[model samples]
Target: MLTPIPLLIIPLAIYNIIAFLTPGVAWTSGLAEIAMMSGVRWTLTVSDVFLALCLFVLLFEVMKATRISSRSIVDHILSLLLFVCALIEFLMVPQAGTSPFALLVAIMLLDVIIGFSVSIRVAQRDVALTAAPDQ
Candidate 1:
């Protein structure tokens, strides 16, 4: 049995990692496909849902980076690499230009930027406090 936090975090982390690591193809990946008919008919795939999940996770990461009191350099650096990898995949990989993963990459980049910016401000404030004597 896993604790609540790890239970929630682990699956999402794995999903993001797998999604990032897996090679892209002529089409997006998904678990299931849905058929719809309205004037015309089309199949909507799980990749659409994955995009929503990615966006939700991105929101979580950004908020966590901003709200968490402790800042880890390694975490931010890894986020940078994540962003870079996604960017490279988008530019170089086949069919990625038409996929949602490109948006995920952009979100990762924003997360890195915001996380570093907030961490720097927090560090500066801490330095000011530590340097000042009790007054």
Candidate 2:
């Protein structure tokens, strides 16, 4: 179960390597350009980065839930925030051109929803674990 975290690391590490190797597709600038083309106002902001970080943290929390404990308060709060930010971003994306902003926001929205579901499941599991055993 704990192996899942390390399994995820492989793909993440591969992505990092590919990103580093591809200088032509500079991730941040490409993302900004896609946002601009799609008419997403102010897509590149500190809030976006913060939301990404929050998603990463949520992923870790989910991994932890699979192995050991249930979802924590921090996980739930972060996931909720991620969902909110994604919704705002999605709603703000203008219908002009091929804006990847909408796509990105959609991905974030999915992640947040999944995180929330996992949190609820974890909470239920926690309750079950804490219940007194029958005589």
Candidate 3:
């Protein structure tokens, strides 16, 4: 039951909650600054952190795609739907117009593409193996 649900949706909901509930928050504002040994200061902003979280979720999404099952098909469908919804919001919604949100949408799209592609490839391999003659 839980397998059909897209994991990336969690980050999407979190982004929406942050955007709509706290309008004053800035994505570009630095969340942390780390100084390197070479005297370089690296600033990690809200946008960077959000995008990193999305990417982490994406890694899990790809891993989940490796399993061949009925639930995985449903998962791919839901992931595609999620990508469409996110794309729509990125294009038409003011709050979602930021670079971080745009990248999130792109990551969702990648998730859908990778999910479907991997499923098909794995399914093909399984079919081929099953059809092979006995030694």
Candidate 4:
């Protein structure tokens, strides 16, 4: 029973790590190359990174609003749906010059780590919430 908060944060943390290791400039270059090969002329600017960060924050807010509980069947289904969609997107997207196998492995690893972390966090939160106050 992974919680959503940790589920989201772990991936963001991994992204931050990757970003730090590669830096924005190099990332942009790689993105540009891929985009060019895909016939997508999108510019990989600082704004793109900013936009991603903003989206991540928005996702976190959504997760907070929809607090997960063990009884939330809908939440579980929705999470599964999201995972499926992400898998489809990763598989269908053009890899261009990038190594598809490596990208897939990384994406899968990220998904697993985030999912597990979130489940644990959610379970912990549920316990804390249900705990009775000390007199």
Candidate 5:
């Protein structure tokens, strides 16, 4: 079973690769390259799609992390490690160091932090509940 935290990488990697390979066209990539509808021009870029994906994964991570269990701890820890990797990659790799990608990395970092905090809160609540005196 794959956790949401690690799943964050797929979108990030896809976005970075597409962005890097494309020669700064200032337009969309893949099938949805360009669009014209309702007298408005729009384009769907890799970063745009992947950012949404990362956000969706963040929601799942938050839900799973807030669950009261030991695995939640491991999930958040792995998330933090992945966050560090993303941060380093964004900082050191020119190809992947775009503003949009950096923003995504920031969002992923937030997921790690929130996941750990939420897990801790949930774990504390579980301990308190189990330790409560029964009649």
Candidate 6:
């Protein structure tokens, strides 16, 4: 049920909401500044935060893909659809033309590829195990 829902959509939807609701918001604008030990300052921007969150969600998405079930198949299909939509948005929409959005699209694409590859590998292993000759 819930397992079929692609987790990557959360960051995509958040980006959409922020981009649409807040015009003139600079993705590169620093959200926080950390003083480094080398007497320098490291600035963390909105884009950095978004990318980090997407990666965290991706970890769970990959874990979910490893489960062999009908829900996982649906998840892979939905993830593929999500990647297509994100890629189209990145290409066609002005608001989605930022580097952060592009990275999100890339993450979604990775999720789809990983999901399918893992599913195929697991299915092959299962087939091999079940098709063993009688001793």
RMSD of each: 6.7, 12.1, 3.1, 12.5, 4.3, 2.5
**Segments in model 4 whose C-alpha atoms lie over 4 Å from true places:** 1-51, 58-72, 95-135
Q: Give the per-residue lDDT of model 3 (tens digit) for 31-71.
A: 99999999999999999999999999999999999987888
Model 6 agreement with the true structure over 2-69: per-residue lDDT tens digits = 56899999999999998999978899999999999999999999999999999999999999999978
In order, candidate lDDTs are 0.57, 0.47, 0.92, 0.46, 0.72, 0.93
User: Among all windows of ten consecutive residues in candidate 6, which has the lowest summed lDDT?
Assistant: 124-133
| Candidate 2 lDDT | 0.47
How does model 6 score by TM-score? 0.92
The candidate 4 region of ten consecutive residues with least summed lDDT is 95-104
Better of 3 and 6 by lDDT: 6
Root mean square deviation (Cα) for candidate 3: 3.1
- Predicted candidate 4 versus true structure: per-residue lDDT over 1-135, tens digit per residue: 334433433443444455456553333443332357668766664435544554564455344434555534444455455446545545664431233223433444444445456666767766754668899
**What TM-score, over all chains together, does every model reach?**
0.56, 0.38, 0.92, 0.33, 0.72, 0.92
Worst 10 residues of 3 by lDDT: 123-132
Give the poorly placed runs of model 2, Cα more than 4 Å off. Answer: 1-71, 93-99, 129-135
Q: How many residue pairs clash in each candidate?
A: 0, 1, 0, 7, 0, 0
Arranged by TM-score, best first? 6, 3, 5, 1, 2, 4
Taking the tens digit of each residue's C-alpha lDDT, what string does model 1 give over 42-63? Answer: 5455566656666676666655
Whole-model lDDT, model 4: 0.46
User: Where is model 5 more than 4 Å wrong at Cα?
Assistant: 1-5, 20-43, 129-135
Clashing pairs in 5: none
